[model samples]
Target: MKYSFVIPCYRSEKTLGKVIDEIQAKMSEMNHQDYEIILINDCSPDNTWGTIRNLCSKNENIIGINHAKNFGQHAALMAGFHFVSGDIVICLDDDGQTPANEVDKLLAKVIDEDYDVAYAEYAHKQHSGFRNWGSHVNKVMTEVMLGKPKELYISSYFAAKRYIVDEMLNYKGAYPYVIGLVLRTTRNICNVEVNHRERTEGASGYNFKKLLGLWMNGFTSFSILPLRIASYGGSAIAFIGFIYALYVIIRKIVAPTEYLGWSSTMAVLLILGGLILLVLGLIGEYVGRIFISINNSPQYVIKNIINYDSVENKN
Candidate 1:
């Protein structure tokens, strides 16, 4: 069974070559003869494509894909997924945070244990405090939005079978969340402990805004739970307003205030106004995403591809 790696690269010119070398050394050590490495450059500003071209020239098994623009990591992975022909496909980061040496741990589950997907569980994650917090929030959101298992850690580092990969590629939404796609596709998932190395090069591209965008993708793209939440919240707010209105009416009948109760009236108006606007915004998010999809905004586009077509992996 040949193993194919679909690695997403963005501004990783400095470290990508080293990562490929590590994979070559490790896979060779494992005596894995039939394998291919497909690298997708996510339109990095740095010379990532040039480095990928160099690597492809040096290694016959390497397949390089260049995106027209940066379409986020998951989209880049999808581009690579379109061309893999291996029995098992492993997804990893361009940086060495998740080492290629840990590939064996994930591969063992699929090859020996007969697991459909093997997610890498880090004993001690090497992310910064802020990034770790973002990840924690991301995990919780996936649990709530995508109905992911509470204990199932959905890290980008995972190994999946070709069938599952095909199932995942069926998704054509404008906002693609790879882990969410996998969870929606299958229930046979497993997690394994692996070593996590701290990034020794450029910082992660995820900012506050990007993290928020990812959260939106997980919530708005694959699930309608947010719309349901808005409905529930609006209903609760209306119920409270009804009770408040009854109280004010009773108060006016019992003893009409000399002051027309302007303060309390304004307070109720403000509260109800804010809640209505919030609900509308939530509704608008869903509608806007639908409109975008209807207009056919592409998830990603390939500007130039090299060393991918002729290289075939015979299963």
Candidate 2:
């Protein structure tokens, strides 16, 4: 089968060449040549593009796509997908953390198991504590939203059949979460345990702030639990206020002196005020997504294309 590997490169000059070499070595061992590696430079402010160009110059099968700007990982993946014309398309990070050797296992599951997509499941993660926690949160949210088997943890290292890639790319939204998109498109998914390694070169691009942003984006784009919780909370608060008003009325009528306390009044007012703001914020989150979508903003802008086929295709 023809395979197209899409690697999103961002300041990966140190490890990109080694990863490519590993992939090529493995492909040679398997006697597979109908393959191409698409390296997308996400406007890295480093020598990443130059290194990729040098590699491509020696190997025609290595295609280099330099984005006009840094479009983030998902956008870079989308851009790479457009150039892939293979039976299967696999996406992996430029970082060497995810071993290239395990890719064959994922491909086996996809081809032999008759699964549309086979994603790598890391048996052991090498991330920090907070990163692990964030991953767990994302997993729970995905399970609740997609109603899939919770065991299937979506890994960035996955092999997808060409049709699945096509369907995922068909989605025209600014906020593109690849796992979410895959779950929405197919249920014929499986996973294979893969070896995870520690990053040997640069620091991770995703920090605490980016992690929080991703969490918020996933919550707003995929689930309505937050909004529903806000609605329920507001209703419960309103009910409590009505009960308190009733108690005040009954006390005033039964014994007028029983209502001579400002503490309860102040407490009730504070609770109500907090609840109002919380509800408004929840609504605002949804509204904010809609506002961004309606503006027809490009998900990512390309400033230059190193070996891109067409200049007009630059967006």
Candidate 3:
């Protein structure tokens, strides 16, 4: 069976070459020389594209994709997914944290046991505490918003069948959440424990800003549960207002000399006003994303492509 390794690269000039070497070595050991490695240079400030071009020139099996701009990690992955021709597709991080040799573990679940998707479950991650905290929140958000299995952990490294990749590509949205796409497709998923290594190059590209953007994409793009929550919140707030009004009426009747101060009135106005604005903002976000998607914004513009394939990508 042909295997395709899809790597989304950003500022990976230091580690990209070693990552490819490891992948080729492991694939050769498995006697799978028909495999292809597709690396996407995500408009990094570094000379990542130059390195990708050099690698592609040396090995015809290595395909190089250069994006017109940095469209984030999921978008870059989608760009690579569009051109992959493997019967089974595997995704990896540009960093060397995920050992290429452990890819066999994910492949085993697919080859030995028939599974549609396999995710790499780290025994213990080597990320910073803050990064781990962000990931934890992201994991919970996936479980709550997308109804993904609580036991299933989604990470950068995973393997999927060609059919799954095809289904995911059908999504034509500005924001693409990989796990959200997978959960929409199938429930036949497995998890494999793998070794996680420390970073040997530059710092992680996933910082505070990117993580916040990813969280917003996860909430706003794939799920309507946030709208539902807003509706429920509105209802609860209305009920509280009614109860407060009843209490005020009772106080006026029981203690005729008592006067309800402007403090309570101002407090109520602020609370309701804030809730109304919050709900409106959420609706506006959804509508804005829909308009952008309808406009047919290119997910990732291709600056250039270097590959030995028969097809040409000049757009």
Quality of model 3 by C-alpha lDDT: 0.91
Off by over 4 Å in 2: 307-315
- Residue-wise lDDT of candidate 3 within 1-315, one digit each (tens)? 888899999999989999999999999898888788899999999999999999999987788999988999999999999988889999999889988888999999977898999999999898888889999999999999999898997888999999999999999998988888999899999899998999899888888999999988988988999999999999999999999999999999999998789997998999999999999999999999999999998788988988846323311
lDDT of each: 0.89, 0.82, 0.91
Task: Give a tens-digit lDDT track for model 2, residues 21-112.
Answer: 99999899888988888999989999999999998888777788888777678878888887787899989989888888778898889888
Candidate 3: lDDT of 190? 89
Which 10 consecutive positions of candidate 1 have the poorest summed lDDT?
306-315
- What TM-score goes with each of the models? 0.97, 0.91, 0.97
Give candidate 1's TM-score.
Answer: 0.97
The positional error of residue 165 in candidate 1, measured at the CA in angstroms, is 0.6
Candidate 1 root-mean-square deviation in Å: 1.4
The residue pairs found clashing in candidate 1 are: none
